[model samples]
Target: MSKARTVRFHEYGGPEVLRLEDVEVGQPGPGEVLLRIEAIGLNRAEALFRGGHYIERARSFPARLGLEASGVVEALGDGVDGLAAGQAVSVVPSFSQNDHGVYAERAIVPASSLVPRPEGLGAVEGAAVWMPYVTAYGGLVEVGGMRAGDTVVLTGASSSVGLAAIRTAHRIGAAPLATTRTRAKRDALLKAGAAEVIVTDEEDVAERVRDLTAGRGADLVFDGVAGPGLTDLVRSVAPGGTVLLYGAVSGLPTPYPGFDLGMPAVSLRTYTMPETTRDPERLRRARAFVESGLRTGFFEPAVDRTFTLDEIVAAHRAMEAGHQVGKIVVTVPH
Candidate 1:
């Protein structure tokens, strides 16, 4: 068939507005591969894009928003090698400008964007894996310079990316202290390899860090929630420690007390996964690193549930609910 049925948003607003309809699917051209999408990972960024708050949607209307998928290579375009048909694969959907999105029965993506699926990993897990794993790997190994025995503090521990950071830190022999706003997830966080779990609602997170580290504080901090959350993270870090700001889920800019930061001499920086993946070398390294971790059972994505293509509205609403742990996947099994 030359045409495919897919989900699309004509205008940005709420989940109820995203509609599923038929669209034309063209053959892959030059290093591209046509995939029968088995699973499509859902992320908070996609939610922002749907609501028109994301930077990627700076252009006009009728955008198909999804960034990661896992499936089999149905057909390969010219100049592609070593990749065969019906081979299970996980892909990072970084395609832009007139490309088929992952939230469909079929999608055409670049071969460079596809990576072989790890042994014993299923399509659902593969779909939800790349973004969080790569984000954590890039920040912890490449940007944060996390070392063995170093103490690290991670905020938003229940988040998929945050949990991946926790696992990555453990793999590197660093100490990971996770923070959660709710008590319900404290045990889950600890079981996920967090050395310590701090419930923000019940404890003074920064003070607890001082107690845990004997006042030296943490050596590195990975933060996804900005605003006041960053203030606590800053206070939790050691004098020479680095704080990496990667997201602002609170929708508030970080408030930094300049005098204290300057007096104590701390390093604060921001990072984005796209920036790290922009360089082909860095991207390849990240992909290999994550695949190795998955193969070794060191890294596993938390998938809460799966939805069909027609369930687009409910899927979006579920994401908005904020109760899901890890990644939410949308399956389009044709």
Candidate 2:
């Protein structure tokens, strides 16, 4: 057995509930691999899970806190093949939050969750890229039917997923129109690859979207904040457009708006990373898209901030504040 440091929460609350604790880890069991975590990515899902607002409630306390991580395979369990010790790999969004997480110095993960890090990407970028890029690729490319010359709308445009979607849209020759309620984030969003920035607090989203598309409206919308504002989204989308609703961060009602008389033939599809996670072919394509972008310098991530493992609470607090322009990452020492 060896000692591993991990971040855990005893009860659901705010970021204060997270604590760094030392624990014992045993040898990897069958189908599992022991990983020496080098870097961990912070996601809003962790904050939601910590605050007891995620779609599913935690089964118990001392719960683990993250899923995306870059680590080296330190040991392999019986029956595990195609991976060896000392190989660099990343933990994708394939683990269940109820039973496992990656916020530790060393933890056992399923071998299937491992992906070779993108060539020339460091641990921090490797950990930072997976969840957002895969989710964006899955929702935008696989599920949303994105194509060249299409117009994509992204709300919560400063979040990691939002930023990834913007880059992905631009990479595929689509016009990306992004939205933020704060005026301060507009320029940052544009610099991060958004084709147009919509200030929802000052300008009408539908009006701006109509103007940008020459009155045709957006072809696809990747929305994280789904609520009453969905009315405006419907107004901004073109006929037969697709709104890939992935998150309900607004904490408001998300009722189906089928009764709206002015509604176009928009296809409202709720999405998550599970679509790619469950399908090998989808996963293969998603990784290829991300890798191509990364190799060509089109997938450069905007890192808003970085924190140490001991400062997990502050990292969570920063994430919950909701003003970051890109990814928030936490680094782990060897």
Candidate 3:
């Protein structure tokens, strides 16, 4: 209809800043489409944005939240093509936060960011797939040059993206050695496709890698949690190996110890999914890779919990608690 429920925050703080309100929906402009948002994917970026700690700060009050969502196409703007009303679709959060967001009952999105929802997946699962899969695909395949038999160390193995990396590595025949903060999640990480789980609190990550890989260290490291342990991670890499720094859970600057830099053989690189999406060729390659994985059952978005529109605060709290084994999703009634 004409009015929709939207999530916004007037002030930057904790989850308490979030407010749900009824907003009027305007007609879609050229290259835009109206959607009945069925499910939304909760991302750390949204939390960071809400807290005013992300790279992009809020320019105005009552700022919107969300990027990834799945819905049915309700209407199309002028010049839109190759889509019809009632078609199921997943929307990628590739545009600027200033221009668009999807945490609403109804949303206007550019057709360019919309893709046909893969078969065998519902709206909630559809919303959970894009970011993690794309980030893993781009980092491991495109940037790391991971292949069969390569050894990968995945940090923050409990995050949705980290879990996806484990699955993708297994599908490619690469060894995914994951690290978690405690043994409480050790079993779940192993079940999620990790070849081995290293409990950082109980064991040394670099020593464990040496033991697992026969002293060769990891061929690549998928690092999402870059804190004081970054030094240990740097030491865990094989000579000439690469480390992909994606996120910082401790909110601390990743340290590069002197020994890590002395060796020209090792490297550290930071990656963001938007880097892949911003390039036409890279975007096409990533999309094809993930699409094939989805079709073949090699990759699936595992949702650890689901929340309704009313429980947004609890959802964020759960996410911040770092207890979820997979993605956190928010569902809306039709």
Candidate 4:
């Protein structure tokens, strides 16, 4: 066993509850591999999980807190093949944090969750890439069947996943309409490849979408902030289109829009990153799609800030501040 510094929370509360401690890390077990972590990615889900608002509650005290990271293989367990020691890799969000979290100097993770880091991608980019891109690809391409010339409405357009969806839509010849609660991020969203930006606070979302789509409505609506506003997003969808709900940042109860509200013949579905990462075939496709975009310079991960592992509490504070326009990453110094 080796000593490693890890982040843990003993109680459900704010970032103040987090504690960094030294712990023993044992060898990888069957179907697992030991990784020397280089960087850790921050997600709103991690913040939600830390605050006990996530779908999956912590199974035990001193619960771990992370799902994404970039590292190098230190050792491989039995039955784990096709990977070698010293190979650079990125961890996918296929497993629960309760089972394997990545916020540490080293960690034991399932071999199936490993993906070879793309060429020329540094630890920070590797750590930041998978979750957002996979979520966007799975929702817009795989599930929604987004096509060329399609109009996609991306709510919470300032988020990492929302920005990724914008680029992914452009990659597929689709036009992305980005939405933000305020105009503070309007120009940044446009510069990030959004065809248009709609300020939810100043404009009627449905009217803006209709005007942008020439009254046909959007072909797909990718929403991360689900709440009362979902009704307007539902009304913004074209007939036969879909409204994919991926996150609940609003922290409010989302009621299904009744048919009497003139809601179109649309499908409302929810998505999580694990839906794509957990399936081998789906994960394979998602990796290829994202890597290709990266190689061609079509997809560039927008990192809003970086922090040292010791500043985990501050990082979570930044995440909850809800003002960042991109991914937040934490570097694990060896």
Candidate 5:
């Protein structure tokens, strides 16, 4: 067994319960690969895991928290072919019922979860890009069925996932309209290929969306916000358009009025990115899409800030603050 630093929760509660501890990194078994994690990407899901919000939980006494990482393969277990030791790789963060946490110096991940790291991309950026890109790509291309010249409105556009949607939309020739509360991020969002950036706080989101769409509303609405924001989103989608409800940032219970369902032909559906990760063929396709975009600069991962493993608590706090522009990462010991 090898030793690694990790943040674990003894009892689910707050970030305060997250403690830095030395843990044993066991060797990979058959069809597994050992990754010497170079970086850990932080997500809101981890915070939810710490707070016991997720339905999935660890089976044993102590559970690891992180889900994605980039690293070099230290060893490969039996039956693992075509991969050797000391290869640079990116770990796919999938929905797993059983697996060790990723927020450690080393982890035993399934061979299938391993993907060749994109060339010319740094280890830290690689770790940060996978989940968000897969999430956005799957939602827009796979679920929403967006097409060229389609106007897509993405709520919470400042989120890493939202920005990924922006990039994917533009790359696919869709007109991307983004919503962010802060004015300072507008230019950055626009530069990232958002056709229009609406200040949700200052501007009437529905009105602005209509104005941008020439009063036809958006063809696709990528809404991570729920509750009242859902109502606004319903109003923002053009008739027969699709509203992909992938996340609920507002935590507001969906309040779809009686007439709401009967009034419009809009398709509102819930999407989870991890679903695509579980299907091997789909995962490969998604990875191929993102990898090609990365090589061409159509997609880029932006890290707003980084913290050491010891500062995992601060990292989670920052993510909860909702002001981070892009992904936040935890740099592991090199």
Candidate 6:
């Protein structure tokens, strides 16, 4: 048995409810691996899970709460192959947080959920890369069949996933039109490889999209903010184009615009990370695609800031503040 400092919340509330406590960790059972954590990646889904707003609620009190992390393999369980102890690895968000969370000094996760960390990638980058890049690749490349010369509009363009989407679009020889609520992030978005930045508050999203696409509208609209504004985003889609609703940071109920707006030949679909991560074949393809992009310099993990494990509360606060331009990482000291 080992003692690990773990983060858990006994109740559903704000970041204030998160508590760091010492817990006993046992040896990895069959098909599991023990990891000495180095860094943890933060996602909005974890925040939602912490606050009881996620699709899956806390199964019990003192619930665990993390999805991705980078670490070194401490030990491997029976029946695990192709991975040796002392190897650098990263945890993919393939399992439920309620079953195996990574916000700790050490954790035991399924061997199938482990990915070998690349040679040049550090712990922080490894932790940051999988969630955003895989999400972007899964949604745009795998699901949407995005190809060269396509026009993709990325909502919440300053986010880590949004930045990854821009890079993925570029990788496929497509043009990425990034959308933010204001001009504060326009230059940054452009610098991050967005072909164009559209300020939602300053201009009509659909009109700007149409204008940018030479009156054709976008071939794909990758939306992380789903709410009443979905109607306008749907309008921004070209005929036979697709609108992929992936996240709900808007915190409001989304309404279907197809019936009310009578948009013809437009398709709207919902996406989540599990759509790719849960399937072994899909995850293998996604991992290969993202790894190739990283190797060729087409994809870079954007980290907005870093915090210590003890400051988990502050990290959550910063995430809720919504000013970050990239991924929020938490470093664990051994």
| Top model number, lDDT | 6
Candidate 2 residue runs with Cα over 4 Å from true position:
261-263
1-334 in candidate 6: lDDT tens per residue? 7799999999999999999999998999999999999999999999999999998999999899999999999999999999999999989898998899999999999999889998899999999999999899999998998999999999998999999999999999999999999899999999999999999989999999999988999999899999998999989989999999999999998999998887568889999988999988999999999889888877888999999999999999999999999999999998
Superposition error at 57 for model 5 (Å): 4.3
Output the better candidate (3/4) by TM-score: 4
Candidate 6, superposed: residue stretches over 4 Å from native: none
Better by TM-score, candidate 6 or 2: 6
How many times do residue backbones clash in model 3?
Answer: 0
Candidate-wise lDDT, in order: 0.83, 0.88, 0.89, 0.93, 0.83, 0.94
> What lDDT does candidate 4 reach at residue 300?
85
Q: How many collisions per candidate? A: 0, 0, 0, 0, 0, 0
Clashing residue pairs found in predicted model 3: none
Which wins on TM-score, candidate 1 or candidate 2? 2
**lDDT by residue for model 5 over 79-170, one digit each (tens)?**
99878898888887784523657888788888888788878888889888998899988889887888999999988888889889998998
Error of 5 at 213 (Å): 1.3
The TM-score obtained by model 3 is 0.96
**Which pairs clash in the backbone of model 5?**
none
Model 3 over residues 1-334: C-alpha lDDT tens digits?
A: 3889998899999998888899888889999999999999998888988998886898888798888999999999999999999999998767766677798999998888888998889999999999898889889998889999999999998899999999889878999999999999999998998999999999999899999999989999999888889888888899989989888777887687646557547788888888887677888888888899999888899899999988888888888888998899999886
lDDT of 1 by residue, 165-223 (tens): 88889888998999888888888888888999999989998899999999899999888
lDDT rank, highest first?
6, 4, 3, 2, 5, 1
Compose the digit string of candidate 2's lDDT tens values, residues 1-334. 6889988889999999998999887888899999999999998788888889987778988788788899899999999999989999988887678867888999888887888887788988888888899999999999999999999999998988999999899888999999998899998888888888999989999889999999999999999999988888888899999988999878799867756845579888799787887688998888888888888998876678899998888998888888788889999987
Greater lDDT among 3 and 4 belongs to: 4
Error of 3 at 228 (Å): 1.2
* lDDT head-to-head 2 vs 6, winner: 6
* Colliding residue pairs in candidate 4: none
